[model samples]
Target: MLQKFGFTQYESQVYEAIFAQDQPLDATSIVNYSNVPKAKIYEVLNRLIDKGTVLTTMHGKKKLYMAVDLQSIILKIRADFEKDIEELKTYKIKRTFTDEHIWTLKDASSIASNIEQLIEEADSSILFLAWNEQMDKYRELLEQKEAEGVHVEVLAVGGLQSSLTHKYSLIPMIEDSKLEPSQLIIVDYAYLLFAGIEHDSWKAIKTTSKPIVKALTDYFYHDVALTQITKKYGDQLLQDEEIARLLARLIY
Candidate 1:
């Protein structure tokens, strides 16, 4: 135990022997109690005395040694550690930017969980474009947002929420949207989540890029406009050269 305070093996044994004694121990007694070689007892005792852990007193021609308070030494070491902890805190600062880059979201359950978190955390608007499955999955969450006075807009087939929100069902894409099934959700114009169907599984990507948010909202608006155009012009929109080009490229 004394070795932890920088005492060597023989010095530690001698110090422990002195600590065990209620009265001081002379070099001969220290070597016998410590089980150390008699030739080495004076050398170890001298080192312990120099290190301030053991004090010596002259008894006739003999020197006797006793240990200092172990509790006081331990308390001093603890105070030094506490001082180091405070100094380390001076260099630690709160980070404003963290990992907001694009991240792969795996599995259907994980996708749903992240979408739920986005809805739960949104401070402003929500822009969503999805198919039947996602609409069924997150319907209650959307209703809760609406109840909280969040501006929620959804574009999907089976226009079930058009009455409660600024919702628009899909206006038939020029290239049929039924071929590839997917979901797109943007919240607060700061975060986006995309879930696309691939065979039996789903692949998703989440990001906090403002440019991506802007682009998605813009594309969603174009579809919203197209829905109005389809209502007004019907088949005649597919005939217009410019609208047809837009429909060809914009497959929402």
Candidate 2:
């Protein structure tokens, strides 16, 4: 585990042994205390000295080594690892997709984290179809996007008899749904993420495909418009059931 910080086993043992003492030790003392091979002691010590983990001085004809401050080693190792990661990230960064492409996120266990990323990526608009369970799972991210000035509209479905709050305009569209408890997210009119938590795993398909996006957007708009019509005409339906049935049959 410590090897990633650039310490070999023998080198780590020698370096740690020196740290365990208040006084500096010669190589012979480090070898005995750390149980490292006596032959490998000076070689490991030299490497540690080069890494600034160990400091060397002369005591008459013999050499003594001391461990550097623990805090200094920690800071140096962290900076070195961060620099390495930045360098590695620069090689062949792939960040584009075709308009016809689709991507899938298949991890059900971390599905909330994936949704959080989608919410963060949204710039101007967000449309979501959420169930009560999904609202609980992703409440903070939804709130965050609302604060960021994205125009958020949601169609809330089953498991809750009422809305989570009235702060966001929501339409209760729960007669029946294939996407019940499944989440449909459209971000910035550019990307779509539809994810469902299944019995065995989470299955999701994300896309930038124009045809698919357009089709889903149309469906979303139709339902939203129908919800408005229902609210406006509900009281008028009390006078006659025939007209109500006809509108239901036509819209549904």
Candidate 3:
């Protein structure tokens, strides 16, 4: 849907008609074929043309409109979106971690897949601090890692009862906890993953270095102050507190 991209109803309809037709039509023809009002057809066509969804050419004294190739337009839209996202991510990295190189991921599936890959690559242990939401979604991945003999330590807003048939440990809720702001996963003392979701999509930033990972691991292990705060007021926090906490623990 182009709703999230800020397309209006008429604009979407015009664009869809053009995309479906795959051929250029004059404004009169568009009005007749699409059943849109004659008065509005020209406006729609001009708007679509401006947006690169339609192409116009002069045929005699009249202008003929043609649909831009749908595939090419879609690819261009996606490419532009990705480029903009990368620029935003670069700015965020510059402000947040000035010395670290950053990479951006654009989709939820990629975030899940990357988390799985990081877990699999762990040679020693996997340390995770997740909010309730992320734990619910990524529980299976953690279980799989545990099955592969990876030591898994998880701290979450709530407590887990049954320890699965794997090398997994869970810390129960602490009283008066202060929830963190993102999801975090550290792998084998070598890599870290920070992830978040917004508008039904997810993004992740990852880093790998033995020293950096080791320092993070130790910091997480010994940061009893943070641990205590998270334990106490974990539930009564932000809307995406769980996911944010998890990401923060892993990346920050």
Question: Model 2 TM-score?
Answer: 0.60
Question: Could you arrange the candidates by lDDT from highest to lowest?
Answer: 1, 2, 3
Lowest lDDT sum, 10 consecutive residues, model 2, at 160-169
Clashing pairs in 1: none
For every candidate, C-alpha RMSD to the true structure in Å: 13.4, 6.6, 14.4
lDDT for each residue of candidate 3 in 103-222, tens digit (9 for 90 to 100): 778876787777766765666788876556666676776777677787887765454433544222234433324433356778766568777655656767777655666676776675
Whole-model lDDT, model 3: 0.65
Task: Write the residue-wise lDDT of candidate 1 on 32-98 in tens digits.
Answer: 8999999888788778777677888888998778888888657755776689887764443433674
lDDT of 2 at 239: 60
Better of 1 and 2 by lDDT: 1
Comparison by TM-score, 1 against 3, better one: 1
Point out the worst 10-residue segment of candidate 1 by lDDT: 89-98
Q: TM-scores for all candidates?
A: 0.55, 0.60, 0.41
The per-residue C-alpha lDDT of model 2 at residue 176 equals: 52
Better of 2 and 3 by TM-score: 2
